[model samples]
Every structure is written in structure tokens, then in C-alpha cells.
Target chain A: MASQPHSLSYVGCNFLRQRLVLSTLSGRPVKIRKIRAKEENPGLRDFEASFIRLIDKVTNGSRIEINQTGTTLYYQPGLLYGGVLEHDCSPHRSIGYYLESLLCLAPFMKHPLRIVLRGVTNDQVDPSVDVLKATALPLLKKFGIDGEGFELKITRRGMPPKGGGEVIFACPVRKVLRPIQSTDPGKIKRIRGTAYSVRVSPQIANRIVDSARSILNKFIPDIYIYTDHMKGTSSGKSPGFGLSLVAETTNGTFLGAELASNPQGQGTAVLPEELGLNCAKLLLEEIYRGGCVDSTNQSLVLLLMTLGQQDVSKVLLGPLSPYTIEFLRHLRSFFQIMFKIETKPSHEELQGGEKVLMTCVGIGFSNLSKTIK
Target chain B: ASESESDRKGIQNAPEKNVDGVEWAESKAVEDEDGGGDVENLLKEEEEYGEENDFSADTAGALKWKEDLTQKAAEAFLRQQQSAPNLRKLVYGTVAEDADEEDDADEELGGLFHVSRPDKESKQKANALDCSKFPVETPQDWDLDEVMNSIRDCFVTGKWEA
Candidate 1:
């Protein structure tokens, strides 16, 4: 059987050499010596409190390193231990502390020695078993400490009627301490834009649709520009007739102009001027307000405005300006209004009724166009 | 005619006499076993009344029933004995003697060896053992040195019971 390491000794009364023997799992021993005051032995410092504070500083990413004999030990972020220390001096000197220190120092144990500390309760008070129950097993698993080597011995230290304290010790299973790492992932990924989509409620959708229809109706109206005709049947010739003037709103800011002209015949034919300018102005306003522009609808709004101003008797047989046509095409789909007009030949002519109809259509189209835009 | 018959039968019976000087007829006849004729009957009647009035029998019976039930309680006891397998028995015998001798030798070795010298395997075994397995017992021989040594061994090995 192997003999236990020898205790420290002093040769003379003046000199005392205290030696500490730490053995590795391979049975190799490392000896450390510290000289102390002759009158009193060295007691433990306030390491317990300091250790607690130290562990508190360690977060998920913290690490500690200790170098011994050219070998570096690394302890990564994990569980920490905290406990009290007890000392015994009889045949030999020994120090006892909680196994918690080992846990805190586990990250630094590249060649750590397996050790144990034992103590009994010094008081009759209820034990704080919750701390042990909660932390012990998890710490063991985290540091990979073998269950067999980790020991906690508690005893009643004092006589009856008085209380004793508890002693806790943790030991590594292997002679050489193993490296550890935190299992927790550090951070979360960030998202851009609105981050999520919101669905429009039925109430909101209904309101939007109702407002769009109302605006469309106010911008376009149904009305007759003329009601009389005198024409040569064979030649299809009509006397020159005055054009009706009508105005419609484009976007929310500009008005579209229209002209209705008559053709050379007894019957009156109407030609309206296209309102591309007003549509462009309105489209620009919408763009300035940070809303998407429907170029097609803008052009159509311009077209209808200008065309409505044409003479009733004139025949518009050819295409208008390319710019006008393009503008009309762009505004075609976006207009909230549909123009409906009817012309009938009657012997009796209502005085200024055509102008009244033109004015009403103009006002209605402006209001509707403004609201929808 | 009734009065004449009465005078003929009792000769007017003599006038009735008062027994004041003697107490009552029953007291005067107390010396005789059967002189106090109705006294014994009166005592018998009183005893019967007492029996009818007293109702402690029911209470006494209840107490007795409770005591009987307690006395008949189920009882169980466990007794443990040293019964090791043959191999373990042999090992225990040899190890026990060796351990005893080694304990004695440990005292001499104290100055040469540090008590805290860590033994990984022994510590592991100690840690693995159930704390309740070895109970603390007062040894027949109180050796401070031996007790201290045992305590040190327990501390180093981290095993203790009871």
C-alpha cells in the first residue's frame, strides 16, 4: 500500500515550514509550502465572500485561466460553487471548504487534483437544502464532474440544545480537470422593414371601398350637351353650332377642361378636348404626398376633361396628340368616374338647360375626382 | 251485637301501652337475630335502589374495551444480522483484521504522512457509499487518537454514516 504524503515540519523553534501535498490521479504528488507566523497559524482569508462576488461577475461568455508548471487550465462559463471553510489541527493540519470553490475554479483546472471537503451542521436551524438540491446536480453535469468523486458530508457539530453548521465539498472525478464550455447561444437575429404583415379588417376595407366609389361618382356625371338638329339628309351637313364648356377635377388640385363642338350638318356632333394637363398636375400632387401614381388613370382623366369641352356639331375623326393619347391611356384605369352623355333631336329647345347640365357635370366631376384622388 | 262479640273475644283488650322508655319495637328486638323483622327487608330494598340508580358499568366496560384494543395492537420489529457470502465473509475477516492493525500503525505513521493526502479512488469510493451505511457509534475503547484518525479518514474520504 502506498503511504500518505508526509506532513510539514519545523527543524528549529524559530523556523516553521508548512507543506501542502496535492496528489494527481496518476499518483504523482505536487508539494507546496507556505511560511506563517510562529505564534499563530494562517487562517483562511475572506475567500468565500470574494468568491461569491467573482462568480456573480461571470456571465454566459466569461472565462478564467490559470497557469501551473507551464500548463494552462481553462474554465469556461458554467456553474459556480459557494460554501464555508473548516479547519482541523490535531495530529496534522487540514483545511475544509465547500465544493463550490471547485466549481467556480473548474474552468482553470487543466491538471486539477481530485479533492474532497467535509463538514457537519453547526446549528439546529433548518438546512438550506434547496440550494444544494437546485445547483448540485446541474453543476455536476455542466462541469462533467463524476458523481462518485463529488462528496457532501453534513453532521451535527455541537452538543444538544445548540446548533452546528453544515460542510459541503465538491471534487472533480478525474485527476486532470477537463475543459468546459457554455451551452447557451448568445444573441438573437434582427429583422428589417415592418417585421410583420398586418391584415386589413373588414370594417376598414368597407370604408375604403365606399370612399373610393363616392369620389369616383363626384368626378364624373351623365348629361346631354345638346338636344336639337337641322341637317341635309343627302350631304349630312349641319350648321355651325357653339361648343359646350365643361370642367372636371384631376388629382386633388387641378381642373380638367372640356369642349363640345358641332359638326357641319343638321344634326349636331360633339367633340371634347382632352384634359392631359390637369391629370399631370394631379398625378404630381399624389407623388409629392408619397402615394403611388397610376399614370394610366391620370392620362384618362386628362382626356375626358379636354374632350368634354368640344363643340357638339364637330366630328373628331383623327387621333389627338401622342402626348394626349399617352396621358389618356395612363389615366384610363385610375379614374373613379365614368362619363355618360345622351343627345336627342327635338323641335323644342330648353333655354340654357344645356349650360346648366354642363355646369352640374363640371361641379360633380370636380367633387368626385377630388374625393377619389 | 258487634260490641258484645268484641268484649267476649278480647275482654276489652288492655289499653295500649307506650314504648317510649325502650325505643321502638324494632330497636328493642335488635339483639335477637330475627327480632328486627323488617330492618333486614329495608336494607335489602335500599341496596336494590342503589343498583338501579348507579350507571358506571357502561363507562367501565368502554374503558376496558379500549384497553383490550390497545393491548392487541399489531407490532413488527426488524433485526439485522451479519450474514455475508462466503467470499465476502473471508474478505471481511481478513480486511477487518488488517484494518485494525493498520489503524494502530497509522498512529506511528502520522508524523510521516499528511492526513489530507488525496486518494482519488478511495475518495471516489467514499463519495459513492451511501451516507447511511456506516452509522456513528461510540467505540468500546475511547482513544482520542484513534477517534481523531477515524474522523480524519472520513473527512479525507468524504464518507460518514449516522
Candidate 2:
């Protein structure tokens, strides 16, 4: 247990989740300091603290230490003893914040992870559960992390401010992930979306659908947007409406865009029609970017590629988001893996924007804790 | 105003005037390296040569051929910039591997007073909110006819290339 590799040290609170997740996956120790050190409330925010607690719940024998002021933290990761667990995520940030990290760590766990995450399911910040369910779950399947058990089910709908939503995420464990080579995104065949409303008029969902369809119908006649208006206990605490759109390509690529109304008592009130129109435009922008994986899941794809079975994995992607760029840097520090990134200009006419072709060989890390039948 | 005053002062000083002339000649020689000045020099020599050969057409055609060479080169460079940006270097800086080497040097500053060494950009990024959603920076108006037409080929209903 004491024979771990040299610990990596970093400063600041940004990207704390990735650093810890990578440390757990790579079996490394990490020390982070100066979390909001200069601020009036200098320390890890409640949401980040909640995230660390969630990480603790999933793993076994992990060592975590923080200073009195909580400005510094040292994490020595333990085995990913993933089992049935539940967490009430801090509502300041949406559950997407926690779910994104869980998505990366789930497949490599000893036991298949079945976790119930309760918090804001849809919010202005972070990728909503609906978008991830539609986009990321399928992307994981492409890497062969699929089985009868893989599922992300939203039992309740919650908006921000006073979140009461709950979602159950279950993923099957894999000893080794299959390397993928997905360069061609192919043409989009159809568009599907969900317009959800809670504690608001159910008619709001229909108005969103109609406005979004009006814009999307010009591209393809195959368009379907479901209206989900959860009521009673399933409706959660706040009143809100939003739309999440996903475009599926002929070659199994998914591009997604979503917009949620501002959390109750925050910002200006958003009109459903305006939100729908803007969300449709956002989807168009995503389609124009045109890659094999959605922008939100770019880092997830790269992470899976790095953990594949000692084989080269190549993926074509749109512009690298700033968050994804930092995740790449963190991957290097943890796994000592560097991606060969090449920009591929869209040579074909009417095919979105410029793309980047990423190539990397996996570290061939196999799950040691996985019990053999 | 300052630039004009400096030029006037340089002219008033005799030694400075000579130095300025030398610097101008040096820049002209550097421009010759770019082949701009070289072409004019070659044409001048050719005009003198053509005085004997009586071939005016060759020199005129040479001048016309070199007319927009610099402009064409500039356009080609801009096209390259728009197309193939070095994404690897963009994502991971050139010194990414050795980025921690500076930290070791900075750590030992004066021993007693710990040096806060994080630069402005990294310091700001260090505490920034961590969220994965990439919002659109500049959304294209979907109502515009040309914007709608730009992505027309992305759909199955669009024409398939034979």
C-alpha cells in the first residue's frame, strides 16, 4: 500500500475532480493547495466539498486531509470499491458536475457502480442529466462499456435554487476498454429532444417544442421533441422549463445542445419560446462543429482512449473547449500519456467547421480488483 | 509629433544623419533579400542590357509577372493560418513537460519567505470554476437564409455526391 508512485502536486481549486479521478484510476497520490486562498471565504466551496465526499463514498481506504481553513488538501486514492451508493449533491452546482466524474471512474471499478445522485438535474451551468443520458451513455457503448446493466434513469426532475431531483446511474464494470477509431462523424439523419417543465404550466413544454421544431424542420423532416412535465413529488422544489437536443448521425455520432431557464430568483425570467429558439440555434452550432463525440464528452472520450488495451485509439473532434484542454494537461501529469493532436480541416463542402484528429496509445491498465468468475 | 521631431533632430546632427543613411541602406539590403529590391535592381540592369539587345518586351513582362508576388505570398500565408493551426502546441504548450522545472527554482527563494510563484494567467485559471459545458461564443442567426444553407448538406435530405 505504501509503494505508490511519486505524488503530483498542484495549486488552486479548479479541476479538483479530474485530478482526484485520475489519481484514483492511476493509483497515484495528489496534493492540492491554495484553494480560493485569496478570497474572503477562502477554501473549497460547499459543492467541491460535496464532490470530495462523493469520491470518498465510492472508493475504499482513501486518505484525504485538509488544513484548518480547508485551503489545502492531500488525497491518497484507494481501490475503487464501487457498490450501490447514494449521494445528495450540493445544489449550488448541478448533479452533472458529480455525474461527469462518475462517468469516468465507473467502468474501471471492482464492482459495477449503481449510484443514486440527488440534486439539480437541469440547470444553467454544467451538462444536464438528460443530455448526458442521450449523448454520453451511447459514446460509452462505442468503447464497449455496454451491457444489460448500463443505464442512466431520471426518476425526478429538479431545477436549481432548491433542488429536489433524483437520478439513478448504473454502469457495468469493464476490465479493459476497447480502443476506438471513429474519424467520420457521418451526416446527421434525425434530431430528437426533450422539453421538460416542472412546477410550470405543462403547455410550456409544447410551446418549446413547437418553436424548436419550426427552426429544425428546415434541415430534416425527421424531428421529434418529447414533452416531459413531471408533477407532484417528481416535480422537485423549483419552477422551471428547458430543452435538450441531440442529433444522431448516420455513423452513430451524437451532437448535443441544451438550455435551462435561469434558476428561480436568479437573473431575468426567460421566455420559453426564446429559450427554445436559442436552444435550437445552439444545436445547429453543435451540428456545425460536427465531430464523432459531443463537445461536452470530449475529455471522457480521451480518458477512455488512454485506459484502452495497449492499442492506438484515434478520434476526430471539433474545436477543443478550454475545459477539455486543461483535462488533457491533467491526463499527462497522471498517466504520462500525451495525445498526438492534428488539426483536420473540413475539406468537404458544407461539412461544419475545422476538426482535430487525436491519436494515442492506451496505458493498458487492467482492473486488478475485479474478481474473476 | 514625436516621430517627426526625432527625424528633424537626427537630420540636424551630422554624424547621426550619416548613421541614419547607413541604417536605411542596411534595411534596403535586407529588402533585397526578400527579392523585392532585387527585382528592381535586376530590371534596371536588364534595361541597360536591353539598350544593346533592343528587347523591351522581356523586361515589361518580367515587371508584370512580379507585380503581386508579395501580395500572393501574404494571401497564401493567411490561408495556411486559417486551415492548419498547430493544435498539439495549442492544447499543450511547447514546454508542458518541463513546466514544473521552474517551480523547483521558485520554491527555494530566500527559504524563509515562501515565494508565491504562480503567474497571472495560471493563477486565474487555478481558481476558475470547473464546468464542462462549452457555451457558444458567437451564435450564428439560424433565421438567415445563407446560414441555413451553409449546413444544408449535413442532413440526409441534402444531395449526395455521386
Candidate 3:
């Protein structure tokens, strides 16, 4: 090697392969050589000397030894090794201190190699307890090691009444090197709606089916409501009265109503709410206001209403029609008034069941007005 | 011979209908003529001739006759002691003594019977295998001791990264 370059770069290589590519700095190849036992790396030597001095100061001038062989370096702080630190400390904390030191020296390394820190104590307060407490997750993230690839294994040792033992903290350096992908989808193209399957109770199902059939039967008098309701309208002809009303426009075509009974003896109306309520609201608002609307607008409104009907069918007999909502509001107010009607003990004795009978009559009249509308 | 005569007389004097009737009478008459001599030899000759051709009375037949006599004698003894107190205990004691004697007789007979071995060499060869000499190999991938030591050091020394 004739006058090899002074600066050297570290690159992964297989010595047996007999191929070498030197890392270049300033348009020149740096010398690639391993540090010998006698000839230590200048930076490493400086670090050891400073670290030992600090330890000696902390330990009140106690002797400290730095053993270096090949690439391995060991530090032995005789009697004062653990004396400088608190007697009882978390192992994680100590490991965190080591990691912090490593991060400070990271810029000096020619090539970054993955560092694994294993074992931290949590079980009992022992010699290694400081290491366990020192290694906080936030501290690790600070060192650019916040990724799924970074792994940590912590061990806890038993003390005193239990037993003194070793704990481990393992932190793999791969986490810092791994790439992160964006989790968010960039733009909103079309709004997607969620679908929910609803079960209808038997009493409610029967009421809905009966009400729907009753409405459909009004269209074609002679035609059977259940059978004819399912049949398509005659060519170029609208469905008869009740059926036509039930077959409201949903997305340019009349969204047909499906009559199905679930396991619970309840009928279910299956329609997408997006096509039902939303479209229906838009269509009905335009239609009621006498605004000129295209066929698509009309169909979209109808589809939204049909979807609204499916959504409401689980609870109510009919779709969430404007009239139905108004009626419900009225009924709710009426019930509130009824609740406010105070009855003294004496009044109760005088009226007996007559007051109840009168309340029922009032409810019946209210329901009749709502139904007619 | 004289004792046999007395036994024949005793059977003849027994309730006539209970004298084992015609079939037993014939057997007894043949036994009396043969004088119970060489009964086993006669049975061996009969067996050599095959069971179908055997003319000598079967051992089973003799056992059955003995059983019948024993049952009759037991019944008679029980009847005689019907009025005695603790009759069950007395009967049980006598039965136990008889069982012990039978067991002793069976042991003697069993000792007299011997079976020859098939092969001495093969048996000895089968027992000669040394099971203790073969050593068991530890699994290559799993060094439990090293892992355990690592764990122990980590926990005791509070050093997590090694």
C-alpha cells in the first residue's frame, strides 16, 4: 500500500470475495483498514480517556480501567463502578444513558451500524434497576429510532427478600433506518357512505307491511296488493295510485320497495340512505318550491327518499316522509302536554278511569288528523 | 380290597333311588372290577387313541361324580347341624381347612410338571445389550444454557444491551 489516503470510510464487505470498492471523499479514495490493538482509533482513545476521567472524578479519584482489544472496548470502574450512581436505579434509565452517549458519538462513525440494547429491569429494584428506569420510550424516539423495526426487550431482576439478578434492555437500531409510508389517502374523490343492516321487530314489521300493502292496494283496486306491488308497471303507464305513490323516483327510475321478513318475524326495507334521504330531500325541496328540475334530479330525490324509507322502516311504519315527521312532532308535543296535566289525589278519585278514557280519545283524534294528511 | 367292599356295601345300603341309578351303577361295577389300579395309565392309553375312540372313563366324569358326592355330603351335614348355634361359622371353618389342603396338593402337582426351554443362546444374546453406553446428543440450534446465562446476567447486572 503506497501512501494510502489519510481519511478512511467504512463499507460493508466480504473479505473472501476478493473484491474491494473504497469509499471516496473529496474526489479521492480513503484508506480502508481495521484499527489494530496497539493503534487505537484517535476518537475512540479520546472518548475512553475523557469517560474514565469523568468516572474517576465521580468516584472520588478511584482507579478506572479501560480495556481495548481489537474492536472491543471494556470499561471497569473497580470499587466505584456503581458508587457514582444512586444505589437503587432503574435498569432502563442506565440503558437510556448509554444510548444517549452513543447518539452523541454517532457522527464520528464511518458507517452506521444497527445497535441492539436488550434487557431493562422492572420487576425489582436491583443493580440493573437504573438501566431499566433510564430507558424511556421518548428518549429512544429522540435518537431517531422511532419505527416499528426498533425492538426493545426489558428484563427485571428480583432483590433482597426475592433475589438479586440481572435485567436486560434490547433496542435494535433498525427502527431509525426504516422508511415510513404515509397513512392518509390524498384526496377525496367521491364520498362513500357506510351501510348498516337493521332488524325490524315483528310488531313493527307487520305494521309496515300492512301499511305499505294498504298504500299499494289503492293504486290498482282489483289487483292483489302483495303480488301486483312487486310486478313492474305496464309499458308506458305509471303504476296505479297507491303503487305509484310507493314507487317514488329514486335515481331516474322508481326505486322498487322490497318486502322481506327477517328471522325475528320483522320486515326489512333495504335501500341505500344516500339515494334515499339525501336525494329525496333535495328533490322534494325543489319540487315543493316549484323549481324547474331535470329527470335526474327527480330520480335522485326519489332514490334518497327510498333510502330514507328503508332507514325508517325498522322503527316506523312508513319512510321518513315530511308528513310523518310533522305528525311525530305533533304527537310528541301532545304527549308532553298530557304529562303536564296534573292530577291531584282527589281528582284521581273523582275521575277514576274516565280521565284515561278522555286522553285516549284525544290521542285517537290527533292520529286521525296525521293519517289523513 | 376290603375297604372297597365296605364302600360298595355303603352305596348298596344308601336310599335305593339315590344310588346313582343305572349309569353310575355300570361305572361303579367297572371300577370295582378294575380295583382302581393304573387309572392314569388307562387314561393315557385312551388319549393316545384320540378322544372319539377313548373307552376309558374321562377325568371330567370322575370329577363330576366327586362333586355330586361332595354336594350330597355337605347338604347332609348342614341338615344335621340345622339346630346348632353358629352353624355358618362352623361350616366356614371346615371349608377353609379343606381349601388349604387342596392348595397344597395343587402346589405339589405344579412342581412335578416341567417345560423345556426353546433356545438358551438366543435368550442370553437378547439380555446382553448394554443400554447405558450410548450418549444422547444435545440439539445444535438451542443452547439453553447460554440463553439462560444471558438472561441471568441482564437481570442481575441491570445491563440490557450486550
- Output the number of the lDDT-best candidate: 2
lDDT, model 1, position A297: 23
User: Candidate 3 clash total?
Assistant: 63
Per-residue accuracy of model 1 over B45-148 as CA lDDT, tens digit each: 43553464244233332223432221122110001011211221221123212332343455455477634433343323212211111111222221233322
Q: Once model 3 is optimally superposed onto the true structure by TM-score, how far is the C-alpha of residue A92 displaced, in angstroms?
A: 16
Candidate of highest TM-score: 2
**Winner by DockQ between candidate 3 and candidate 2:** 2
DockQ of each: 0.00, 0.42, 0.00
A best-first ranking of the candidates according to their TM-score comes to: 2, 1, 3
Task: Give lDDT: candidate 2, residue A216.
Answer: 95
Put down candidate 1 lDDT per residue, A1-373, tens digits, no spaces.
2564332221111100000001111122222212111214331223222332333332222243433321222223332222333332111111122232234343233322333222222111111122232223343443245666465543312111211223344444232222222211111111000000011122322232233223222222321122122222311111221111121112111111111122223234322112212222221222111111111122222222322222221111111222222222222222222222112111122100110001002111111111121
Q: Which candidate is the best by DockQ?
A: 2
Tens digits of per-residue lDDT for model 2, A1-373: 6577899988888888899999999989999988888789999889999999999999999999999999999999988999999999999999999999999999988899999999999998899999999999999999899999999999999899999999999999988889999998878899999999999999999999999999999899999999999999999999999999999989999999999998888899999999999999999999888789989999999999999999999999999998889889888888999998877877776777888899999999898888888
TM per candidate: 0.16, 0.85, 0.14
- Better lDDT candidate (1, 3): 3
Docking class of 3: incorrect
Model 1 bad stretches (over 4 Å): A1-34, A38-137, A146-179, A183-373, B1-162
